[model samples]
Every structure is written in C-alpha cells, then in structure tokens.
Target: MRVFAVAEIKFGELDPVSIELLNLANSIKGDGTAEAVVIGNGISKYAEELAKYADRVWKIEDSSLENYNPELYVDVLSQLFSKEKPDIVLVANSSRGSEFAPALATKLNAPVITDIVGLDTSNGIKATRYIFQGKLLVDILVKDGDTSVFTVRQGVFKEGSEVGGEVVDAGIKPSVTPKREFSQIIEPEVGEVDISQADIIVSVGRGIEDASNIELAEELADALGGVVAGSRPVIDSGWLPKDRQVGISGKTVKPKLYLALGISGAFQHIMGMKDSELIIAVNKDPEAPIFGVAQYGIVGDIFEIVPALVDKLREIKG
Candidate 1:
C-alpha cells in the first residue's frame, strides 16, 4: 500500500503543517509507503526536499499556477490521482487543502477522513477523529474502495526527522488551462506574529458583545502582555480580522495561557484550541461548555470582572 501526501510549498520551503502530516503518516507505517505532491509554478525543483519525507515526490509546474486558482488546481490534482492509483491520498487541513480534498473525494467516489487524529488500515482503512470539542474520540471505518482521502488537522503531528522524502518522479502530464472566471487571487495583507504558535493568547468571544466592546478584551490582554484573538463570529462580523479567529474554521492556536472571555465553546471552535497549556474561561453561564476544558472557570460578567482582574494582575506582577 502506498500513500499520497500533498506537499504545501510556500516561498520555496515546505509548509510546517505538511511536515507534521508526513510525520504522522510515517508513524503508522506498515506495507504502506508515503509520497507527496508539490504543486506550484516552479515546484518541480523542490523534489529533493519533499523526497526527504516522502518516498516519491510528484511535482507540477505552470506559471499560471504561481497564484492559486482553486478550479485549475483541482483539475491538475484530479488528473494525477487518476493514474497514481495510490491506496490513500493525504492532504493537510490548510485552507487550500481543505477545499481541494473534499471536492477530489467526491469525484473519485472515495471516502474522506477530515480533521482526523489517527488511522488504522488493519480493519480496511478505519480512522478516528475528535468529537465534542476533543471531549471524546470516536472511531469510524472508511466506507468505500481501498482509496481514501485523509485531510489531517494541522497540529496533530509534531515535527520529526526527515526520513522517506526520497524523490521519485510521478510522471504526470499537465492539462490545458481551463478559462478561469475567478476575478483574481488576492492574498490578504497581514503584519502580525502568527497567533497559532503564540505562548499566550487572550481571545474574546460573543459574550464580549459588539465590536466596540472589544476594548475590554484588549485592555485585559495588554495587562497580561499577551496576544489577542477572537471566535469565528467575531472575525466574520469584522470585529476582528480572519487571522485573529480561533478554532477549526480559523487558525488552531495552542498558547501557554489561553484566556477566553465570554466565549461559550463550540465543538468546532474548541477542537482547535483545546490543546492550550492553561485554559481560563470567563463566562457568566456556569454550564457553558468552555468550562469543560478550562483549567480555571469564572462565572461572571466580563464588564465587571475584568477591570478588577487586570488591576490585581498588575499589582501581583509589580
């Protein structure tokens, strides 16, 4: 059995999340071998690096692909899968990977395992995932042919040694570019430290209320000397930027001190952030699910509670 892992290449280097997936894929090694696909304008040359973690490195190049076009990439990747006939296809659960994996699975009529933590092929390709905000681990068997599409969560695996990254050519052909109706690819302008790896995160949720109320969370974050983040609704409502949103839909952050203000934890939201070192939830509702994973729980209104906490924290720090 052979596995196809998608290579996430950026600025000529492999994305950290892709490396993490390769490590996990390598761990459950048996008769199965792991390879990766490097897709970009000039990614064929990076076969050496991809070969460090995969048995074979399939590279595709086209100047048109320099900028990501979802339609065009799906076409190219689908074509590669047609001929490769690997036992499994593994993709990183990043933005582009998430979009392509499901669509490709639909076309192949193959089973898909999304945001999965572990896998077992012994029982004909069974996989497991975290359910109820990592509160439970549910196991499910893959339903379909031997081919399965696995989109792995980004932080599931740790960085490890570069082992089977040997570069064998995939020998795949490129198809004619489809007329792209996409307006244009616009990379969002960002100038902040990546919150996903921050040592401490002070995030606000719906309980904080309107966008104007954000200052309350900001002040507390400042008092703690930590970074600020928000839930999906907060970022989608433009109270904060997309990069600032935490949980599965947004960036999965694992901070040392994760302070959630007024955010009732949702399953999709908490699965990403439940790995923090210390979780402190400040929600008035005592039964809020955020308390389930939080190391410290404060059932009180943020408006009245934060000022005192900030002042006390400052005094203690001094």
Candidate 2:
C-alpha cells in the first residue's frame, strides 16, 4: 500500500493543495508508507518542507520543469512511476492536476479518477465523487491490482502537521523534446487587500445587483474591520478583483467569520468558505442554499438589511 503524492509548487512555494494531497495520502495509507515527489527547477529547496508530511520526499529537479508543461510533467512522472510502481498516486484537482493526472494515468496504464472529495481504503480503494454538477455524491471502487491515480478536490482534506521524514534527491533530470515551449506567466493586477488572508470576509454576490451597490458591502466590512470579497458574479461583473472572488474557480478561504450577502450558496462557493468558523448569510430568498451551511441566516433584502447592520455596528463601536 505505497502511496505517492505529487507535489505542486507555484512561485517557488509549495501549493497548499500539494500539502492537502499528502494529508489525504496519510489517511488512506493503512500501515503502508507515504512519499511525495517534488518536481521543478530549483524546487529541491522545498524538500525539507514536504518531508514534514511525507515519509520520504523525492526532489526531482529539472531546469526544463521550472514552468509547468503538461506534456513534460506527464513524461517525467510516467518514467518515475514505471520504476516506483506505487499502489496509489494522489494529485490535486487543480488546473495543473486536472491536466496532468489523466495523461499520466494513460502512460502508466492505470485507472484514474477526478474531482474526488472523499477516500476510504477500508473497502479496497473506494472514493466519493460528485456528479450532476456537485449535486450528488457517488462512491467508486477500483478493483484489485489496478494502480489508482486520483485528482483530489482542493479544500476537501485537512493538511497534516509537520513531522520528521527523509529527503531524497532523485537526481532524475528528464530530457525530452516538447511540442510546446514554456512561456511567461501573466499575473492579474494587484489589489489593496488579499481577502484570502483576512480574518473576516464580507462576500457579495449577484444579489448586490449593481456595481455602485458594492459600497454597501464595503461599508459593512469596514464597520467590522474586515475585508470585502465577492462571488464569481461580482468578479465577472468587474465589481471585484479576481483575487477577491470566493469559490472553487477562485480562492479557497477559511476565515474566522464569513459574511455572505446576496449569495445563493452554490456548492462551488460553499466548497471554498464552508470551513469558516462562523458563517452568516443574508438573502431575500429564505431557501437559498447558502443557509444550509450558515450558522446564522437572515431572510430579507440585503439592500435593507446591510444598511441597518452597518448602523448598528457603528453605534455599538461608539
């Protein structure tokens, strides 16, 4: 029951999902060992950090892999897996993971599953995945002798605490011609506040309605000494920065207080913020799904509720 977790690094730092994959591997290892593969140029620097969660960390450094190339990643990982022949392989269900996992599975002649949210080794490698746009969950089982590759959904697993482990520099630099060349990464314009790090987040959605109305949410956030964020609708409407968007397509946040305004609470949105310690939702429709996970629910028009809430907060402060 050897488990191999693929480590993904961004901007010279290990992506949070990479650690989550290692944690998931630890849970299902079942007396077997867990290891991680760190791949990229100069990424060996992170071997010590990854070793905390993995029994063994393999640093696969290569100048060509400094930037992620799906073709190159699949090629390199395939070669490594061929010799390692681990029982289970875990990768994050992120943009990079979605692209690399299936391709790697094909090369390795293994069974691959995507967007898995739960894992259970008690029943011989069974996993829970969502279907019908995340409305339903179905358990899938892999027959014996089938090497399993999984693209695990982000934010679904907790990251394990740092522990002592061994680091091994595989010293495997793969040389292969790629049809595509690595290119420059385009970054979004920076904003004043990184909502992901904020302790309290006031998130707006289509219920905010107009761009000018964002000031209302901002006022509420200011009163609470928090930051303003929004759902995809607000970002797509150009009312909020992309970094401030909260959902699977956006940033996964675990703020102490998550105040959702006018959000209908789609599962994608829930997946990101459901981990918040306290969630308060205000929407005109009482049946909005946001209320499902909310600790407090206010059924009313946000336009009317926000102003009153802001006034009370200001009064309390005075």
Candidate 3:
C-alpha cells in the first residue's frame, strides 16, 4: 500500500492530529511507503518533525498558502495526488479537513470515508464510522487495489514509533484562484480556564438541575485541584462558558482524570472525553449512558454525593 497523510498546521505550528494521521498511515502501510504531505507558508520545521515517522515527507511551502483556503488546498492536493497517485490519502477530520476532503475526493474520483474511528486491513479495508449521531457504528468496505481518502477522527489512534525518513520539497503550485480572500483570524476570547488543557476536569450536565446549583460542581472541582467544565446543556443554560463545554459540538479533552457529575453521557459528550486516562461518573440513574464509558460509576444524587466528596478531599488535603 502507498499512503499519503496530509499534515495540518495551525497558528504557525503543526496540529497534533497531524501526528495521529501519520501513526494511522504507518500502521497500515506495512512495507509500503507512508509519506507525509505538509502545505503552508513556512512549514519546514513541521515537515522535518514528521520525517521522523513517515517514510518520506513532502513539504509544499508558499507565501500564498499562509492561511487555510479550501479551494487552494483542494487544488494543490488534487494536483499532487495526480502525480504521486497514492493508493490511500489520510486526512485529519478537523475543521479544514472536513471542508476539503469531499472536494478532493471528487477531483481524484475516489471514495472518501470520513470520521473513521476504526480500521481493519486483514480483509481488504473495512472502516468503522458512527451514524445517526453516534447511535450506531457502520463498517465501510473499500475494494482492493482502489484509491481512497479517509478522514480519521482525532485521538482514535496511538502515536507510532519514529523511524527516520527523508524530506523532499514538493514544488507544486496552486493554479486555482481562491474564491475567498484571506483576512485576519478572529480568535475566541480566552476564558478563565482552557478545559482542553486541564489535567483534571469536573464536568456537569443537565442532571445538574439549575444554574445556581453549579456551585456544588465548582466546589468539588476546587477541592480536587481541577477546573470546572460542563456538557452542552449547562453551557446553553448559561451556567458555564462555551469554552468550558465538552462534547462533539464543543471541545475535545483528554484529561488525566475526568469526573463527570450529573452527566447522562450522551454520545456527543462521550466522544469528547472518552480518551481520558480515567473517567468517574456520578449520576442518580444507573442506566445513564455516561457510566458506560466511565472507569468508575456512582449511582447517587450529585446534590448528596458532591458535598461528601468535597469534604473528603479537603480532609485529605489537611
């Protein structure tokens, strides 16, 4: 198999999902070539870093490609793939990837399997992706000897061992005129805490009852030396800021310890924090879906359990 993985760059640095894409490619490539393709204004450093894992790194740098343009990305990648004719093209299922993968597939006349969470190569290529808002998992099969593009979900694959490779400059330039012009990037306002980076997170959900009741979760988070976050419901209710929301629609997090309080564990919420090292869910309903993914489960009312847990943690601190 000949595989080509696209490396995504954000804020002048390589996106972490780029490494995950490389890892996925390397795992399935076997003895075949696993190449990394990076396109941006100044991505030489990222290309060099990717060379440690990929069989070859193709760096496409140009001043016109400083920011992400869907048309330009599709144009450049379509041209490059036309020359290379890779059997498999791997892309991260990020904001940018979601925009261009389908268009690139159309240009290449290949099948595109998006948001794939699992893959089986023993019997051809069978990819697993969620359907109906993650209510079910469906397997998509690709015929042998066929070219295809796959957008892999983030945090699904582990990082592969680094094997040194060579870096080459891909001199392909985009000929397509972008329909849109590059403008200033409007960054989101920084909140009191970035839950994505928090080591320990205490997250609440609709089960939290009311906005005023959020203090219980806050106190518990404080006692545990963690940051407070919430599910979409709590955020929508104005109890927590958008930055503190954890779900498919919000932020993905992989904290060392994730304590879900009063969370019912919708699939969207599970998708965001399922990669956490340890998950502990506390909800009164034993059948709550959140407990399915949690390492530890407590079927009790948060109003009663949170205060007890906070007191216990404070006693331990003393």
Candidate 4:
C-alpha cells in the first residue's frame, strides 16, 4: 500500500492541515510505503522539514509556483503522479485541495472522498465522513484502482503533531513556465479567532436583524468568553465580516460549545458547524432544523431573548 500525501504551504512551513495529514500518514497504512508530495519554488528546504515527519518528501520547484495559479500547480502535480504512480493520495479539505482532489480523482479514475472525519483502516483504508449535517457518520471505501485520494476535513484530527520524520527527495521534472502573471492578490482582512480551534463559539445569524443587534451577540460571546461567528446573511449583509460566516460555503468549525443566535439552520449552514461538541440554538421557529441538533433549544425571537440571556450571563459572571 503506497501513499502519496499532498501538502502545500504559504508564507513558510507546512500549514496545520498538512501537519494533520502527516500525523495520519505516520500511523495508519493500507499496504505500501508512505511518501509526501510538496510543491513550491524553493520548497527544497521545506522538503527537508517534511522528511523529519514523513517517510519521503517529493519536491517540485517552478518559478511560476511562487504563488498559486491553480492551472499551473495542477499541471505540475498531474505530471508527477503519472510518473510516480502512488496508490493512495491524501490532501486537506482546504480550498485548493478540495478544488484539486476531484480533478485528480477524475484523472486517475479513482474515487474521491471529502471532509473525512475518521478513518477505518481496519478494513482496507475505509474513511468516515458526515452526511446529512453530521447527523450520521458514513464509512467510505474506495475500490482498488489506480490511486485513491482523500481530502481531510480540518479539526477532525487531534492536535500536538510534531514535525519529525525520514527524508527522500523526489527531484521532479519542471513544466513549461506559466505565461500568466499574477499582479496582486487581495486577501480579506479578518479578526483573530481560529473558530475551528475555539472550544466555545457564539454565532449570530440573520435573525439578529439590524447591525446594532449584533452587539447583543457580541455581549453574549464576551460573557461566555467565546469567539463570535455568524452565518452568510449576517456577514454578507455587512453585519459582520465575511470571515465570520459559518456555512458550507464558509470555514468549518469544531468547537466544544456552539451557540446559534437567530439562525435557522439551513443544511448548507449546518454542514460547516455540525462537528461541534454541544450545540445550543435560540430561534423563534421551534420547527427550525437548528433545534434538531441543539442540545438546549430556546424558541423565541432574538430581540427579547438575547437581552435577558445577556443579563443572566453577566449576573453569573459578576
């Protein structure tokens, strides 16, 4: 059972998701050797870093790869896979990894699984992913084929993974330089809250209504000493930054305490946060799906309910 784990990094060093993959690859196995594929311009040094954690590190350096151009990066990896022919591939369920994993799966004629929370290697590398907003855990197994690739969901694996493993350099062939020039990449500015890492998160949704109403949610979050997050409408309507959106289209989280304020849990919104430990929802609609998973449910409008709750929280804190 040979595996090629794909890890990409920016700024410096492998990201948290890559470290998670390394820890996973280091322990379990399906059949063959475990190898890592890293791509960057001067990624050779980082290749040495990964070697301390992985069995082997394959390197691809192209000037065009200084920044991510999906087309160019994909072309490089595709060429490498054709030559290397590893059996299983693992990647993070990140933006690029999600976009690229299916494309690679299509190219290799193998099944692709996304947002995997657990792996059942007991039966030939089967994985478990949430279906129906984590209401059920589905076990997935890819039939024997050219290569099976997995893009893991962030925060599923345990933390405190150290970077230390063996080193093998894959001196991969360079591709034609990409003609397109990347001028400026604009990244959205977001405040600090690794919501995925937070044990408690209090998120406001469209039900909060006005921009001023958001302060109530913030007060609640502060009283709980938890980070504040929100749904798409809450963010898109300029009630909050886009970074705070918690939904299928936004960042996923796995907090120990998740408080839903005025948000009707649409399946898409629920998908991103369903991995939370304990969910508490405050919504006027008792029929809202948010109530389905909410350990504690309050059926009321945010306008009346939040202030009372805030007072209670402050009293307790005081």
| Poorest lDDT segment (10 consecutive residues) of candidate 2 | 188-197
User: On residues 1-318, what C-alpha lDDT tens digit does candidate 1 reach at each position?
Assistant: 778778786545667777676677676656667777777776765667767877667777666667666666677778887887867888887778888888888877788878887778776777888776656879988775857888887665654567755665555545656666546555446656567757788899998889999887888888888888999889888998887878866777767799999899998778778888899999999999999999999999999998898889889999
For model 3, the local distance difference test gives 0.87
Model 2 / residue 131 / CA error / Å: 1.8
Best by lDDT: 3
Off by over 4 Å in 2: 192-199, 222-227, 232-238, 241-254, 266-272, 284-289, 299-318
Clashes of each: 5, 0, 0, 8
Model 3 over residues 1-318: C-alpha lDDT tens digits? 888999998777787788878888888887788899999887878988999989999987788998999999998888888788898999988888998999999988899999888776666888888777666779989987558999987766654789799999889888978989998987666557657668899999998899899899889988988999999999998999887889776777888899999899988889889999999999999999998999999999999999999999999999
Give me candidate 2's TM-score against the actual structure: 0.84
Give candidate 3's error at residue 310 in angstroms: 4.4
lDDT, candidate 4, 1-318, per-residue tens: 666778878546567667567667765654545677888787777777777667677888766677766666667778888888876788888888888788778877778889887765556768888787656668887676777788887766635345455655555655656566778766545565556667888998888889998888888888888989998888889887776778756677878899999989987788888778899999998899999878999998888887898899888878
lDDT score for candidate 1 against the true structure: 0.78
Decide which is better by lDDT, 1 or 2: 2
Best by TM-score: 3
Model 3 residue runs over 4 Å out of place are: 192-199, 215-227, 236-238, 241-254, 266-268, 271-275, 286-289, 307-318
* Candidate 2 pairs with clashing backbones: none
C-alpha lDDT score of every prediction, in listed order: 0.78, 0.86, 0.87, 0.77
* Tens-digit per-residue lDDT, 1-318, candidate 2: 889999888765788777888888888888888899988887756888888898999888877888989888888887777777889999988789998899999888889999887889986889888776545669998888758899987666764666578998776777688898977887645556656557899999999999999999999999999999999889999998787888767777778899999999998889779998899999999899999999999999999999999999999999
Residue 61 displacement (Å), model 4:
4.1
What CA RMSD would you report for each candidate? Answer: 4.5, 3.2, 3.0, 4.4
